[model samples]
Target: MHADILLRGGDIVDGTGAPRRRGDVAITDDRITATGDLSDWTAGRDIDCTGRIVAPGFIDPHVHHDEIVLTDPGMDCMLSQGVTTIINGNCGFSIAPLTATGPLPQPLGMILSNDAPRFATYAAYRDRLRADPPAVNTACLIGHGTLRINEVANLDRPADRDEIAVMARALDAALSEGGIGLSTGPFYPPARASTTGELTEMARVAQAHGKLYVTHMRDEGDRVIEALDETFQIGRDACCGVHVSHHKCAGLANHGLSETTLAMIDRAMQTQDVGLDTTPWTASSTMLNSGRHRQASRVIVADSTPHPEMAGRDLADIAAGWGTDIDTAMERLLPATGIFFIMDEGDVRRILAYEHTIICSDGIARGSHPHPRVWGTFPRVLGHYVRDAGVFDLETAIRRMTSMPADRFGLRDRGRIAEGTYADAVIFDAATIREANDYAHPTRPAEGIDLVFVNGRESWRSGVHSGARAGVVL
Candidate 1:
């Protein structure tokens, strides 16, 4: 058969946790037309992937790229890491259905920054994305925080029944407009006062639409177990799938808690729908004013609106330079982002190795010096975790980043390299695929991603973007 493009002679991992096999994949338009033993197939373009591995393109299930996708449609950072699709509006922040005017409050402002556009409705947001597509496919979840911001007049307390009703209506509208799920960040200031009942009510809206309820949880450190119970309870009460975004034990005191948390999740799964995603790194990034720095052993200033020059400096160094304490320095850098080093490496490995744990960047795509995960997460998993540390087999790792997320998020046709599926795939040398960026050089593209295709169109190739905006708003 004649095909638009042919990937010849590569070890296909297929993103199903199956063992890799040498094969050929033929693409016709935006779907995989054939796979395996296609040497006779004629194609307009033939790619020799002889010494590389071809797998479904990575899917980052948790990210805060609601605005970056529009601002930087190329999405070079994600493309270079072989991520062909991303689920944004994680951690309870979305830039849509916005009615509240003026500055965007703390964590929300951190998400949209100062210049990102706002949408009056989810439909408007989706329309804009359709009009100007990015380099990677995008799916979004309606944020409970955004809902609360629009409906609740007060931010320091739980939303009253009337407010809850209003938020529910907004959520229902967003879900009907194609939001894949409902996401909450009770951990953040905007939603910190939200009661479990309030969350359950909002989740019920998502459930009614047959979507998932994703959360960053109310707490991830001292009260994590309590938070997990609350999460499961909300899922049960709402009858919706619950997904924990960026699961981690955040404080030094909470080291090695994944053993307990994973067990808790396993038990919850028996009775309710439960899933989670986590990053490969130990350091977590968020707004500096969120007080997560208090739990961190060390903190680095990722970006500062007030002191823009402090982007990559250590918080302690900045504190010392200013002749003040860390807290004061942090306050001085108000409206900023910080990377907290609190997670134990052991816990990171345990969570990553968990059979059901999907991989995510939890990447906030703004800031002068964004977290390294934005540019390096997928490659780090392939190189450092899978290859060097032997966290899991390459096949399993691919499953976590691809099929698991696609299935969890209900993107039925996008995450496998088989016939009739969307042709979103990545080709790379497993031996050399490694993250090229770190905190020191946070924005560097990954090293060994040879080619990435989104909807059968080349988006990235050989360390450079192909400038193809073939992505769709899935």
Candidate 2:
């Protein structure tokens, strides 16, 4: 049979955590038409994938590409790492369901800059995505903080009953309009006042719609255990699946706490639906004003509007140069982003090695000096973790980056290599695939990702983008 593209003689991981097998994959249009022995299948385009690993394209389950997906649709940072799909609207902040058009509050403004366009409804945002598609497919969650921004007038206190009801209605409508779930970040200032009852009400709306409750828990430091309890309680109360975003133990005092936290998650998953994701790096990034710097051993100013020249400089150095304390320097860099080295290396390794853990970038696609995770996540796992450090096997790593997240997020057809699945695949030399970027050079593309296909179109090849905008809002 004639196929649109023929990928010949490669070791197919298939993204099911199964053993790799030498086979061929045939694509016609946007779906995998056939796999296995397709010697007789001819195609309009044939590529030799011999000696390379042909696996399902990576899916970043957590990211902040809400506005960049519209502004910089090429998404080179993601595409270069073999990521074909990304889940957006994480950490209780999204670009849509927004009406207030002035400056965004802290944390939200950290990711979505002050000038980001506002969409009054989730449907409007989704419509814009469809009209001007990005290079990668996206599944979004409705942000709890965004709901507060829309419905609640007071930011320093918990939402009133009427406010909660209005937020619930908005969340329900967003979920019905294609939101994958509800994401909360009580850790952020805007949602800090949200009580467990308020979160439960919002989660119930998502639950009614059969969606998940994803969270950047209220705390990931000393109070992380309490935060986990709160997350589980809300999940149980709402009867919904729970996803922990960027599961980590911040602060030196909390080092080695993943043993306790992962155990808690394991115990909860026995009676509840629970999943979590983590980045491969030990450092975390967010707004400079997040107060995470108190726990950080070092901080780098990722971006600062007031001091544009300070990007990529250490916060301490900036403070010293300005003849002021770190806090004062930080205050002057309002509406800025910082990368904090607050997490322990051991904790990062432990979380990434967790059996239920899905790999994600949690990348903010902005700033002059963005976190290396944006361009390095998938490859770092594949090369550094899988090959160098032996954190997991190649097949297992592929599974975490592909099918595990796809199944969790309900993107069933896009993360597998079996027949009838969407043709999203990456071909790379397994031995050489590794991230090229680091904290110093954060935007460099990854090495050894020879070719990438999204929806049967060659979106990236040989370190160059094909300019194929075949992505859709999933």
Candidate 3:
């Protein structure tokens, strides 16, 4: 058969948690036309994948790449790590369908390392993004804060009835604009002011369209259980599926709470609806230069900043140099610094192994020393964790990184190497895969991944792209 592209002689894992099988994948245009023993398949070009694992490129279910460089939002940081599709506006943060001229700090650039990029709203941003967008397939959520900012016209107070109704109308409009669901950061400023009832109202609109709920939750450490319960209640009341982004128990004070957090999530998943995403890292990063996060200083460590020397040091340690307590030091450094080292490895793996679990980088590659997950997450999972430690089989790990995320997040036409799906795929040496980034050395690329194809065209060669543009803005 004539084919546009043919992946020849690879051991295919297919991303289904099933055993690997040998085959060739034939592609025509953007879709996989067929997959079998295709020794006779003829194509204009062929990629020899002998002794490699050809599988669906990963779909990161939760990521903050919505805040990456919009002008170049190719999602390259993630793509370099073998991620082809990404769910953005996670942790209740997304750029979307709204009407406005944009906002302070503009949600896609680094005005402040901790500062989040904001857009006018889903409708407004969608129009702008359609005019010009970065590469990579993107699915988005309507942020709850944007709705409040749209309807309330103020960020310091609760919404009245008329305000709630207006916000509801705006949310409904976003849903009509192809928003996948609702996302909220109960931890962020404008969103933090909203009551549970306010969230319920917004979620109700999303539920009306069969949308999903994604949140940063009210807490990640001491209040994790309560936050999970609150999340459960939101799903229960709104009748929507709820997903927790970047699950962790952060502080040293919150140590050993991984079991508690997982148990709570398990109970919630069993009884109601709850799902979670985890990045492969021992630290967390955020812009907590003020307020509640500042008050909880010991758990927060700044990974980067305007101050050159202090950029990579932990907050508590930095606090000592400044002759201040941890919280006070946070207040002093918060404006310039970003936070990290929030969770350990114990919780990361347990969460990754959950059947309902999906892998995400929560990838934010900013600051002098950005989060390592941005560069090395997927390879590290396959190389270090699976091949090296044997914590999970390569097939099981691939499922979490690929098809599982695609199924749970409502991404259509990608994720699995099935008939008629988009031929966005990867070829990697299973035995040689290795993630090369660490906190101290954050910009190194992953190893063992040899080729990446987007929409059936070769995009990379050992992390160096061959000047291809088959990837598109979703």
Ranking by lDDT: 2, 1, 3
lDDT string, candidate 3, 94-199, tens digits: 5554333444322222321233434545666666556665556677777776666556666667788888898788788877876777888887666777888888
On residues 1-474, what C-alpha lDDT tens digit does candidate 2 reach at each position?
A: 999999999999999999999999999999999999999999999999999999998999899999999889999998899999999999999887887667788787876767778889999999999999999998898899998987778888999999999898889889999999999999998999999999999999989988999999999998999999999999999998999999999998999999999999999999999999999998999999888999999999999998889999999999999999999999998778999999888899999898999999999978889999989999999999999999999999999999999999999797899999999999999999999999999999999999999999999998999999989899
Clashing pairs in 1: none
TM-score list, all predictions: 0.99, 0.99, 0.90
Location of the lowest summed lDDT over 10 successive residues in candidate 2: 106-115
**Which regions of candidate 2 are displaced past 4 Å?**
none
The best candidate by lDDT is 2
Model 1 regions more than 4 Å off = none
Model 3 gets an lDDT of 0.73
RMSD (Å) of each candidate, 1 decimal: 0.8, 0.7, 3.1
Full-model lDDT for every candidate: 0.92, 0.93, 0.73
Residue 291's lDDT in candidate 1? 77
lDDT of 3 at 369: 66
Off by over 4 Å in 3: 67-69, 97-124, 131-133, 290-309, 320-328
